[model samples]
Target chain A: MKYLNKSWIRKSSLFILSMILVSPLFAWAANAVDYSEPLENAAHQIGAIGEGYSLFSGIFPEYSLPGTNIVLDTAVAGFFGVLVTFGLAWSIGRIIKKGNE
Target chain B: MHIPDGYLDLWLCGIFYLLTLIVLSYSGYKARENLDEKKVPLIGVVAAAIFAAQMLNWPIPGGTSAHFVGGALAAILLGPYVGVLSMASVVTVQALMFGDGGILALGANIWNMALIDVFVGYLIFRLFKNKNKSIAAFLAGWIAITAASLFVGIQTGLSTIFKFQLQTTLLIMVIGHGVLGIIEGAITASAYRYLIDVRPDFFEKSNKKEVEA
Candidate 1:
């Protein structure tokens, strides 16, 4: 038990220390006020729902639609993204499972 | 913590994309080697859950809303390889289909949340799970989320394209995320307990060939 405790302590410390070393690379923000906000806006404009897939949720958004709102558009995009992922995963899963069986 | 497009310098984005691609490729290789057919669809479902969970933000104190990233939970439940793959899939879809993150910033987001958080959380849990499961889960979630914030703060702070003081943003990001990380830890730990109660086979490494444990 003593030896096991020592081993865990050593491993935990090492992991913690590595995190500290990499801490400088990221700081998460719940709500951010930074230089990036304006850029996000610009990107959204560039990635308008009608435009090509430029990284804003694939074309579910309709910022310029006659009655569309950005929030709704975003949610629509989220829904689509979820569906696509699940669909792909489920299909591939079946294929793999069948091969194994 | 998705940075919209045009936030980071295009060159910086390029670099991050390259790095993310390399890391993701390695993760794919690992998954292919270790994963079994039975668990493949679960990865997809987990990714879908994470992507959906991120959209549901509840108000935290100080006018901020916090949402589940699910990186830690995925790692704890699925192991590192599957966790990373699921997260990567979630991140990719969020970018491609929902535009949750900037196209250019997708790599950075993946680097922070998918790669760093999942790896850190999984490694910690694997290390300490035998002794104290709750502590392992809690610590894994906390560190993973906190580290993700730190990673983003550091990048945004250091970037010349953004005219913000690195110290201020870094401090705010760290402190803000520090508070949120607690919630993340609690959620992860509780979720682990619940899942174990319901799906003990998922954790029984000896019983399942597909599981990462």
Candidate 2:
């Protein structure tokens, strides 16, 4: 095993542990009554089959309008936005670096 | 839990939207500080890749499907600020173009998923970076996602609480997100490994310094 950074590892583990402990408490306090049923049911369903296929059908219901156009538009726009932003950021970085050099 | 339109109190949605904008703008500023030109194209490419990946939803067992959230993974691969911005961009485009999430609830969605997932998750991942690169990466990716998923659950619970339907919403969000978390973790770990192998420089700490310089 790689010699781990003891302090870093300890801190990370502690932080995660704390968050894990604190989150449930926050959830419990946030709700006055038990709200575990729907989640349990959903879990049961996911557990029985698998995650991959189930998510598709669940989020995008068949009964709902086939919003294929919307989906495609979102996907396309997101694609280009990321592409453009990245290009701009990268080109600017190169320019700055050249100036520095 | 992409809160649909008219699900939550409008007041709450507005409050959250403002909060989301503030946090995202701040993150954007931070990202700009260290961002270099070379990395810009790469970031965009990665964002596109994440967008494509999210589109390819595999079916989950429980009459639902789950896809990569990519927020935690992005935070892990890039830094938290960049990750959150990337996610926010994705969310923004999705809302505006596809109407997947409520326009009013954009703030809540971004805060819960993008901010919490990316910023908090990456912070957790960085904490675990003990040079056991693989294990650290796995845990960081996995745990960060799990935490984010739970936050989404809590957000739902809060929304329902206001409506006196706290039990139902909380349950749905928690359970749905819990399972989703596992898928997220696996995908994140795998993706991180793949990226590290293919583009070691991208994951290198020195890259940040290079940008800053």
- Highest TM-score against the true fold, candidate: 1
Cα error, residue B199 of model 1, in Å, equals: 0.7
lDDT of each: 0.65, 0.56
User: Chain B of candidate 1 versus the native chain B: what TM-score?
Assistant: 0.92
Instruction: Show model 2 residue runs off by greater than 4 Å.
Output: A1-101, B160-168, B205-213
Candidate 2 local lDDT, A54-98, one digit each (tens): 112222232122545433433334444444434543444344345
Q: Which digits, one per residue and each the tens of the lDDT, describe model 2 over residues B1-213? A: 455454455677787888888887676666666665555544544555565455444444333445566777777766776677667766655555445566776787778767887876676666766666666666655566566656555554565323434565556665656666776777777777876785577767533652353
lDDT of prediction 1: 0.65
lDDT of 1 by residue, B120-161 (tens): 887777778879999889988988888888887777677666
Q: What's model 2's lDDT at A13?
A: 41
User: Could you tell me how far off, in angstroms, the CA of residue A14 lies in candidate 2 after the best superposition?
Assistant: 41
Error of 2 at A36 (Å): 20
